[model samples]
Target: MTTPSTAGSLRSRAAESPVDCDVVVAGAGPAGLMLAGELRAGGASVIVLERLTEINPLLKAGTLNRPNIEAFYRRGLLPVLRQAQQETEWTVSYISSRRSDGTSTLPRFSGHFAAIMLSEELLDESDPDLAGLNPPDMVDLVHQKQVEAILADRAAGLGAEVRRGVEVTGFEQDAEGVTVTTGKGPIRCGWLVGCDGGRSTVRKLAGFDFPGTAPEITGYHGVADITGVQDLGVGWHATDTGVYLNDPPRGRITTVAFDGAPAGHDTPATAEDLQAAIRHVTGADATVTGITSLTRFTDNTRQATTYRQGRVLLAGDAAHVHPPFGGQGLNLSVGDAMNLGWKLAATVRGTAPDGLLDTYTAERHPLGAWVLNWTRAQIAVMRPEPHARALREVVADLARTVDGATYFAKKISGISQRYDLSGDNPLVGASAPDYELADGSRLADHMHDGRALLLDPTGARHDLVAPYRDRMRTITTAPLTDDAPAAMFIRPDGYVAWAGEPGRDSLDEALRTWLGAPVAYPSQTPDVVAAQR
Candidate 1:
C-alpha cells in the first residue's frame, strides 16, 4: 500500500502529466458524489468538480422512493440519512377528494398520480411479486441538501478529491483519453462523466442530442407570508384551470397553471406573481405579504439520444430531465449513478469485459425513456381541458380499485423497475433481496465494499469462485428465503447477474462474462495453466 504522501506525490505528478486521474466527474450533486464514492470504493482515482463554491440549502426533492431507499441501505448510508431526516422537519399531507357532506376522506395510499390517490390496500404485502420491494420506511422524506451532504461526506471519506468552484466549459476526447477544459484550467483523464443538472454545460458542449417534448405548463413554488385567505387544508387540489397545493408549516405553496405559458427566464418570481398563480389555480383571494424565495419550473421533458459518446458519458439530470411529478427525478438520477459507477470503474481499471461499458447505455436509456413517458402520462391526465378532466375522473375511480391502485403504487415506488438482461429466472434482472444468513449477516451487509458477490447457500461453489477471489466475494450460508436459489451472482449495483442451482454451465459463462476470466494459481502446473488459458 502507498502512503498518503506518496499518493499525493503521484497525483501531483499525474496532474502535471497527460492524465490527471482515471475518472473526472463534472458536478458534485448527489449523483456525482455518489458515483465518486462508488468509483473510489472500486479502487479508482476520481476527481469531482463542482461549479458552486458552497453547498446549496434549497430542498429540491422532499422524498426518496423505494429504489433510492434500498440503494442507500446497500451503501450503509441509510442510517446517516435517517439521522439527517430526524434533524429536518417536513410537512407531508395525503391528497384525496372531498365528500359531498363537506368531510374529507382519508387517502388509501400515501402517493398520488395526476392528483389521483393510489390505494395501498391493493398491495398485498405477503405476495411474492412484492418481495424485496418494500423496506423499512419505504418512502423517506428527507431534504435534498441533507442527501447531498451525506453523499459528499461519503465520497470524501472514500478518498475521492472534490474541488469546488471549478466549472467545466468543454471537453475533447481522443482514442487515448479525454482533455477536459474547465474554468480554472485543463485536466486530462481516462474517462469523463457529466452529472450536471438539467442545464448541463457538458451535455451542450459535448454535442449530445437531447430530444423530447416541450413544456406544457408553468409551475411555481414559493415560501411567502400570507393573510386574508381561507386555509385550504394541506394537500393537492385540482381545479378547473390547474392544481395547487399548500402546506402551512413550511410556508410552502405550489401551483401548476395550464396556460401553456413559460415563465420568464431572466426575471425572478415575486410575491405578487405567486399570489396571482395561487388565486388563478384555487379561485380564492389569497394575499401574499412577503416572499422569501420563488422559483418556476415546467413539464418540459428531454433525454439524451445516447448516454455515452466515446469516452465521455452522462448521468443524472444531464442524461435525462423531466417534470418531478411523482418525485422520481432524484431517485432516477441516483439510480443512474449507482448503475454506472461500478461499470465505469471497471473500465478505468482495465478489467471490464467486452461491451461492458456499452451496457451502461443499453440498460439506462430505456429506463430513462420509461420515466419520461411516465411523467408525460401524468401531465396528460392533469391537463385542464374537458377531455382531460373527464379522463382524470375516470382515473380517480380506477385508482380506488385494487388492480389500478396496485399498478400505480408499483410504478410510483419503483418496485417494478427491472433491467432487461438475458436470463430465464425472473429474479435475474431484479434487485437482489436482502436475505439474512444463519450467521445474522444480511446480503446488503456484504455489498458495501463495491465488489461482486457470489452467494452460495449450499457452500458448493467455493472452487468455482476461488480463482476470482480478488474481484468477487463468496458467501457461504443457508438459504434464507423460500425463493432463494442454491447460488446467486450479484453485481456491484445489487442487481442479480445470475442465479441457479449449483453445477450449471451457464454459471461458469456468467462468471467469466461479468468478473472476467479467472487467474491461474501458483499450484497449477504449466500444462494445466496453458489448458486453462
Candidate 2:
C-alpha cells in the first residue's frame, strides 16, 4: 500500500488538475475497463467512453489463462470470478474438474496449438522449462462479458466515470495533453489510451502505423439452433475443406475456411451465412435454423509500430490484433492494462522514472508480435491443403510426446511469456511466485492496493529498502527454499524487477530504475543512506 504522505501528494496533484481527467479511455471493453480501474487504483483520474449502452453478449473469449487469473487473484476478485463461473455455468467443468488437493478429476487438457490438443498426461512436469509455471488451479473458463462487468464495477467504485453511448470521433494531441472529440463533447485529458477493438478509430485519429500480414482464412463463431448435423461431433475437426469445432451442449459452432478476408466486416453474419460456412468447412449436411448470436472474423494479423505517440497511447486490440485462437486475446489485453496502468498513473502523479512509459512498447510489442506469429503458425498448419494437412499430422505426432506437449503447454498456457529485463537471475523478468508469508497469507494478499513490494523472506534486506516506503511495501517472511530467490523486488504488475543474486544488478539499482529515486525516511541513518547510494 502507498504511504499516507505519498497518497496525499498524489491527491493534491489530482486536485490541481487542469484537464477533466488524468486519462481518457476510448473503449469500455475488457481492456478499457481494466485500465480505468487500474488507473483509479494507482491514483489517476479516468473517464471511460463506451459506444454501447449495454455489454455485448457474444461468446468471444471463453477462457482466462494464468496471468489473467493471477491478476484477478491479486486484486482479490477471484471470489467474484468464481461466483460468475457458478452463475453462468460457463466452463464450470473446468472448475469442478480440479479437486481441492490440486489433482484433476478429469483428463487434463491444458490447451492446443492450431487444432492439436495438448494432454497434460503427456507432459513432463519436472522439466526445467516448466519451473515456476502456472498450476492447473490458475486457469479457468470465464466469460468476457462477466470480466467486463466486473472491471466496470471496480472502476466505478474507484471513482472512474464511465459514459455510455459516447463515441470518439476524433482526437488531437499537443505538447501537453489530448483533446478527445466525442459525441457528448470534447474531453480533455493528460493522456489518451485507445483500447477499442481491431477497427480502432483512436488508432486512426492518432495516426499510429499498423502493419502486418494479410488474412488467409475467414472464421465464424456463433451459437444457433441446428438440424441435420447429428454426426458433427465436439472438438476440432481438421477436414480437407477447413477446420471446424462444435460444442453441441452449448449450441456453439466455429468454422474457419481458407478463404480470403470477408467481403466486408461491417455486414452482420446471417444464419444462412453460418450454414454455408458449416457446410463448406465440415462438409456436413448441417443447417442453421435460427441464430442466437453470430460474428465474423478473419485471421488478419496486425500490430502498432509503437504503443505511444506523445500523449496518446494504445493497448489491447488497438495496439495489436490477430485471429482469436487459443483464447489469448483477452489475456493479452488484460496484461496490457496491468502493465500500463501503474506506469501511466505514476507518470500522471509526477513520480515516474525517466523513460518508464516508453518501456510499455519495448516490452509488450515483441510479445504481441509473438502472439501474431503463434496464430499465424496455427493457420499455416491448418490451411486445408494437402501439404498443410500432412505437416499437421507430423506436428500431431510430436504433440503426443512428453517433451512436445510441455513445449506447447508452455506457449499456449502463457507461461513462457517473459519480458527481457537483462538480468542474470532467471526470475528477474518472470512473474513473482505466490510465496506464503510468515503470517500465513499469500504474497498476492498484500498487493490489492497496487503498490510495489519488497519481499525479504530472510529478513536481511529491510535496511536496503527502508527509504522507499512511500513507493512500496516490505514484508518479512519465512525463509524461502534454496530454489527460490532469497529476496525479490516485485513490481506492481507482478513481475520481478530484481532478485538478490550475486552476479545480478543490485536491489537499489533496480528500485531506482523502476520506481525512481528513493526518499529520505527519518528511520534511515547515514549508513543506510550510503548503502542506497
Candidate 3:
C-alpha cells in the first residue's frame, strides 16, 4: 500500500533529480515554439514539453493579422511559411451600402470592431499619429496549422528539444532554480515558462491567481456536411435567438447563443449537438450529416493576476484568455511570445538589466487587459437585446465615417498600440516601420539574426558603439526621412529603444539600458606589450 509518507518520499526523490536545461517551456503551441526558437538563437538551452503526441490538424484561427505577419517577416520565416502553404488574399468588408438602383458597393476596410467595418480608405498614412504605416495586403491568408508547422520546423532546426506526450503535473521553485514535476520525471531548470494554452497546468500548479468574469454566452464552431439545410449564405447574421454564420467554401458553420451556460471542455461535441445549436440560433431545421470538428468557446475572459511568480512565468494564452473575436487571440498570444522571449532569454543568460524581466508583465498586462476589454465590448454590442442592436447600428454608422473607421482600423490591426516606454520620439514605443536605407535594403533585411540594431546615418557614433558591437549590430545608412534622427537604437523585438542625434553619453546609457553592459576587453600584460614593441 502507498501511504502518505511513502508517496511524499517518492516525490522528494523525484525532485532531487538532475537539472535538465536552462529553460523548460510547457506546451508546444505557436508561443512555445516561437519562444524556443528565440531562446535557442539567444544562446540558451530549452526543452518544450507538450501533452499532445502529434500536431492538431484542426483549423482554429484562419488568418494572421498584420503585426504577426510583420513578426514572421522580421524572423525570415515568411518565405518559408509561404512555401509550405498557399497564400490567399483577404479583405475586410466593413459596411456595404445598397444604392437606390439596388446595387451594393463594397467599401474596402482593413478590419472591423464589433462587426462594424474599419475602412482602409480612411487611414492617412502620412499622419504622424498613424506613424506613416499602411496595413499589409488584406488578401494574405494562412492556416493556423501551417503557422504551427513552420514554427515547429524552425525551433527543431535551432536544436530545441521538444518532448511529446509529457504532461507537467506540478513544480517546486526556490532561489536557485525550478524543478518541474512531469509525468516522465522531475526536470530541473533555471526557469520554467508556461505557454500552455488557456487551462494551463503550469499556471494552476504554480498557484497563480486567475480572476476574471464568467462567460456570458456559449459559442460554437464546427465544420460539417449538412443535409436539409437552408442556405443562410456566407457572412455574419444576427437573428432573434442570437447569431449564425455559414461559409460554403470552407464547409464551416458558427453560432452564438445566449444560453447563460458554458459548455464542458471534456465533452466531445457531436453532429447532433451542432445541429441543435444551429436550430437554436437560426430556428431552422438544418440537419448535420457529419462533423469533422466541433468545438465550444465562450467569452469567459480571464487573466493571470501576475505573470511571474518566482522563477515561473506565463505567456500567450497561459497568461490571458478571451473570446476569439476579430481573430485577436492568436495575434495577441504571438505578440506575448515575441515580447517575453528575448527578456526571458537574457534573464537566463544573466545579461539582462535590472527590472528587465519585470517589464514583461508590466508591458504585457495592460495589453492583455485591453484585449479582454475589447472582446467584452464586442460581446456587449453583439448581444440579442434591443439596446445592443440599436447601439450596433450607431456603431456601424460611425464606422462608415472616415475618422471613426481609421481609429478602428488602427486598433484592430495592432498598429495603434504604443507601449509606455520612456521616450519622447513618436516612433519610440511604436512598431518599427520598414525603413528604406540608401542602399535600398529595408530594416527587416538586417534583423534576421535577432540582435539589436544601431543605425547611424551620419557615422558619428561609430566609436561610441564599438564597445558594444558584440551585443549589437551597427549599420551606416542614409536617413529614412528628411527629419529623421542621426542615429537610432532598435531592440531585438523591433521596438525603438532610443532615437536622437548621436551623443556619446546618451548612446552609452541607452546601450547599457537595453543590451546590458558591454563586454570588457582584457588588457595586455607588460611583458607581452614589450615583446610586441
C-alpha lDDT score of every prediction, in listed order: 0.80, 0.83, 0.76
> What is candidate 2's lDDT per residue for 299-328, written digit by digit as tens?
989999999988899999999999988888
What is the per-residue lDDT of model 1 for residues 63-135, given as tens digits with 9 covering 90 to 100? Answer: 8887788888888786788677666644223212334432236544548898666667676666566665645
Candidate 3 C-alpha lDDT tens digits along 1-533: 11222434433543675467888999999889888988887777899999999888776887677678777877888677655444432212211243443223754457567655466777766656566453222213576777888889888998899999999999889766788898898899878999999999989889899999998787889989986555674567788878777776667888888887564656866787788889999877899988877778888899999999888999889999999878888888888888888777776666677677788898889999999999999989889899999998888888887777777777777877767887767778767777776776777777776777887766677656766665567777664568767778888888888888757887788788776766554531111100000
For model 3, the local distance difference test gives: 0.76
User: How well does candidate 2 match the true structure in TM-score terms?
Assistant: 0.92
Instruction: Output the lDDT of residue 387, model 2.
Output: 88
Top candidate (TM-score): 2
Between candidates 1 and 3, the TM-score winner: 1
User: How much lDDT does candidate 2 score?
Assistant: 0.83
Question: Model 1: which ten-residue window has the lowest total lDDT?
Answer: 524-533
Clash pairs, model 2 backbone? none
Better of 1 and 3 by lDDT: 1
